[model samples]
Target: MALWILCLLVVLGMGFNMVSGQGEDPFGPEGGRRREMVPAMFIFGDSLIDNGNNNDLPSFAKANYFPYGIDFNGGPTGRFSNGYTMVDEIAELLGLPLIPAYSEASGDQVLHGVNYASAAAGILDITGRNFVGRIPFDQQIRNFQNTLDQITDNLGAVDAAQALARCIFFVGMGSNDYLNNYLMPNYPTRNQYNGQQYADLLVQQYTQQLKTLYNLGARKFVLAGLGRMGCIPSILAQSTAGSCSEEVNQLVLPFNANVKAMLNSLNVNLPGARFIYIEIAHLFEDLIANSKIYGFSVVNRACCGIGRNRGQITCLPFQTPCENRDQYVFWDAFHPTEKVNIIMARKAFNGDTSIVYPMNIEQLANIDIEPN
Candidate 1:
């Protein structure tokens, strides 16, 4: 019965892609004129999208060793995947080069953008204390403010604001606020509030942080919602039968719901703010359910990890990973493979309203903001 359901989902997915013209290559024709969709792309979040930001941080959450980034151009560049991250693909689709990490970005590089995401970072400042040295969301904002100051120093306040107004502020946060803090045994968050209350608390803080970005000159926003956290290798490994923890899955819905509502409210309240929500959870669930159609043969295990489902421990240094990395959905206990990232990024870039609510990244980029 489950097999039949999965087959049905694949059929539906294929048909939807065909109708939506999503099957076409997004990189454009060879030697074609490549036009940038936005002036710059400022990124924030945790390891799922962190390129090399956490490499220098004294944190256990770091992934600067072998078996990580095995498929990328520069091997082991602190990405928690075998190859490209979602944002990397998004940058390519937008006709821009890869956005450098804030720690490494310098000189004229700041004109394109910087990624401030850190491994184990979360919406709450104290959420990733277990990792030590992880930069929380608030601190990431401050880092961006510093970047903005440098840009303003070079371009002057009015010109900097004009350039920033045309940039894309891509934020994908809150996963660790659950995986590392609320759900961890050492944390007291679980006992402090119920699921709904915890979600409300996170979004409330999130709203202020985003508004701070807006006040600092961000006008176009692409807010990525959390994926199916319970289905990740780490959470699945916790089950005796290697099944997804439905309880963990249920815990995050309130957060996604509150985030969607918050983005909608921000759109109407904040002038010139065009905030869109990426249905990441929905897209991930689809990919997992219809794995075969998407060319993923292993949906439950990591390509490079230890123990049952290769999930008991994350990928280690110099470990031999599965050769057929493209067939796996995950590269580690918690992060998706480059293949999955590519699919997700492409969808968010050009997918219809069902995947990216209010508007897609392409639409958001094309929106012209009146100078203030």
Candidate 2:
């Protein structure tokens, strides 16, 4: 009887060990089992979520150097922010690992998803020509196609198509199209189109681009609208008082409105489409208006740049960022710190209706979809 009892006790202990050693799932809540909300995430945008895609590109906008990633675990990885970007935070909330840049991703890395964003890129191909080398939205889409082809080769056409339809395509382009193209005095875009006309042109082009993505098996999309461009440190620095340029803000308002309307049209036109529009401008205005509530003391200044508001020049090599990085909203002339990124991502993922409309990322990820 004693021997039988010992054997039973040992078996119970082994079973307990096995359960404990299985580890908690990173996809679920803390100490919960791992489960993927979506099959993967395919990111497309500009500097806001470039990750390391621009590192190897012959672009002056690259950030894979010192002082850029001081707060990130892996160091400067071509992300404009000091740490993670909004997408990085969103990926964490979705229970996935950091999405690799398309420039460096290969084989299985493409399965989890890939970041095709390039710093200084815009919806228009000619937008960032001054940057010398940047992958525009068109090329980024092509890169994604190549990735899709590889996935198809690996998993067969049917499986690859199904996997892609279940993934999330997060797009945050167009800001540079305005800032780096239309608003830049050196560019002729402004000459060709007025503010409203330019907005219309962008929407026309963007509408077609999104349709291309839909055709490529992207069913779930999180399209981030443009933030207040005039409020960023770079634009504010243009003012002696370091105040936001209301005119610039007005310039992009129509674009944001058009984008939201376009998404609505797309949802109706495309079958099985689930599009979530992130009200970035509204969220940004709220954070700026209630900085103290968000624990930010300085929203007008860049944490690591030169001149007034740190907006005159971007973070140069070896530039020492402010000691209290989290207290500042702007990481450089244009980007947000990791803390701000986290806040924005969290809000976009699961915040109330004001920040994210037509359902948040969490909702978009979990919604039922027919297999493609």
Candidate 3:
């Protein structure tokens, strides 16, 4: 009985290590710099990962204001969260510097990376029309192509292809397609197709979008799947019972599943492709299910919004957020707290197949691909 109990305890410890990292820091010893895992990391996504790409655009999804960056070093650089984003944390783990937004990047900054992620961006062109001036996924891809053109100009085609082949392309999209398009009463997406049909359509377009990036010399890819949208503060605010809307949760499952299958197919079909999927939905589910274990006390309300559940609207310009920001699961109506982002990023960096599929970011970065 004693031996059996010890074995059970060891198994439980391993599981916890998988969820929360194994306490390994990718950063090296004190006073010494570790070599970056990849040459650069290009980001493509929406508000969840948008550093400041939408600040200049005439869009309602901007977050360049007080309280938004209260916890960050430089105040409110247009990140939608209180501090670092998941991509930011991932960048640090890869030993790369914080990538600048494409709108702000210039000169040698492009050598490291450029974030083309924009607030309210989506898989479909018209997904965020309500926000007006927001860049969609297709436009973001064009922006990447523009960056590639400049890289080729500087390094020449051969060196540019080799450099890009070693860089990591991190793409997190599709959230806004549901949040601001299909789910919105003002949009015609729901009327045009049901949930399953819409998922297929989005995945079809998404596959092509990824292929374009691949053709442009991207070899390593980290595609983040959509999370549990129903539990977000915005969706919860619409719930009459102050609980998660199962219908909303059910609506996004097909999209995640289809994306996973798509990634597998891409890896097999696309030459030199190393595509990995991040289980955002499963991570969110585990975090919410074991909130206390993760130190999140407030899971249902926003830390800085107005109206019911503090989610009727996102944070106002100078609104003061909760004092215990780290204890809250969400920072605003549609985004997770920086703490949650940290957890997700760390898991993706070193966790097993359960969190990041086929292989983790650390493994992906270390992959030795022959120049093609």
* TM-scores, each model vs. reference: 0.90, 0.90, 0.91
Cα error of candidate 1 at position 32, Å: 9.0
Candidate 3 colliding pairs: none
Taking the tens digit of each residue's C-alpha lDDT, what string does model 1 give over 161-280?
Answer: 666677788999999999999999999889999999999999999999999999987889999999889989998898889999999999999999999999989989998889999999
Quote the positional error of residue 128 for candidate 1 in Å.
1.1
Q: Assess the local accuracy of residue 151 in candidate 3 as a C-alpha lDDT between 0 and 100.
A: 38
Q: Which residue pairs overlap in candidate 1's backbone?
A: none
Clashes of 2: 1
lDDT of 2 by residue, 239-335 (tens): 9999999999999989999999998898888999988999999889999899999999999999999998998999999989899998999999999
- Error in Å for residue 364 of model 3: 0.4
Off by over 4 Å in 1: 1-33
Question: Residue 120's C-alpha lDDT in candidate 3?
Answer: 90
lDDT score of residue 188 within candidate 3: 85
Candidate 3 segments exceeding 4 Å error: 1-32
Model 1: weakest 10-residue lDDT segment is: 4-13
